[model samples]
Target: MRATALSLASLPARPHKTADLAPGTPAAVVTAPPPRRPRGRPRKTAQERSDGNRRRQLMDGAAQLFRSKGFAATGTRDIAAAAGMHSGSPFYHFASKSALLFAVMNEGMASAVQSQQQALAVLAPQAPARECLRVLIRHHFEVLLGPRSSFIAVMLYEWRSLTPVQRRRIALVKDSYEAAWMPALTALGQQGLLQAEPGVARLFIFGALNWAVQWFAPDKGKSLDELTEQALALFIHAG
Candidate 1:
């Protein structure tokens, strides 16, 4: 009897059907509904898609204003107005003016990294180290003085305005961007084309290239190709 009772208790519970009920008999068994599966994340709406674009607009406008007027001199209202946003709108995207400044620098460094990668990607797989260095110099000029110049320009000058924590964060990205040039510099040093040590040469080369932002004028001075050639001449010895 105990074994029979255990077997009966162990049996699966069968769902009750109304048709299985005897006439005038109330159904004695009820089953709870199955638990629902958790839902996946919802798709972004059109407005949500535009939020990224708005953030980019704010960064671009802030970069231009910051480069032109200096970070301290520029106000959030000025950035919003330049971006065609309402005066108070920048706060919606950034917690404070310093936060916006850090965003501008962080995003600017990211863009620089991407541009450098693209510039290097186009080289032939077997391209010489000199060619790689040349591409890097030309792209550096474009980054500093070309159509996308404002972002890096802001990064160069407004660096002092960022807190130490922000500086360290931006430095990581900046280091990665600079790392791309090392293999080429090392190769050139191996070939005796580089006059200085590869590491020292890298520092000197960037110092020279970055200084162009102060005096380079597209209309009045050498074109980017001419500048690249001159930089190569200055840094690399003829083989």
Candidate 2:
């Protein structure tokens, strides 16, 4: 039997004023929220399950090989072998190696955007623009330097390997991630914290953060906190 899920959070309520309560009235019962419904959709059909698993394996395996081995050197068979599928199996999911590369790049951008938005959501609603920028920078570092970073890393280094159509498709999502940062940077410009044009400033910020993939190493050098501090110091002027 499926156990009903209950919310661990309590409904917020203020203390009831005695003046507001009737003399003979019983205290109100705090009912448990009608047992919370399960969070996600119904279970996937077996074929859907199989397709989802295969697609995930292919993407994961492709990201690993593409980041470590140049796109040109990694073939469909290599991705398949890494994914534990038969040599021809990847073709079941992707038309060609180029198509697989595009999927990896697309997924990387989508994931990065999702993560950045979530990080911003947790900040206080009225967070200062500089504080928001700091969170943005820190989030970029996490995406670029954290575990499973190969997808974005692949997107960074193998961009030229994509065909024109593939490039166009990836850029659509990439632009949104950039869009998310622009408003905060524009606010900084208004506050005189930024010296360069806001658009150019955005480019410079991304350039600096993305370059960490090339040189920043957790074992050998600065941690994300140090990088975040140094980056803010470089980009934002102290008043």
Clashes in predicted model 1? 0
Tell me the tens digit of each residue's lDDT in model 1 across 190-221: 99999799889889889999999889998887
How many angstroms is residue 13 displaced in model 2 relative to the true structure, after the best TM-score fit? Answer: 50
For each candidate in turn, give its C-alpha RMSD to the true structure in angstroms: 20.9, 16.9
Q: Can you tell me which runs of candidate 2 are displaced by over 4 Å?
A: 1-51
Task: State TM-scores per candidate.
Answer: 0.76, 0.77
Error of 1 at 78 (Å): 1.2
Ten consecutive residues with minimal summed lDDT in candidate 2?
A: 15-24
Candidate 1 residue 103 Cα shift, in angstroms, is 1.6
Which 10-residue span in candidate 1 carries the lowest summed lDDT?
15-24
Number of clashes found in candidate 2: 0
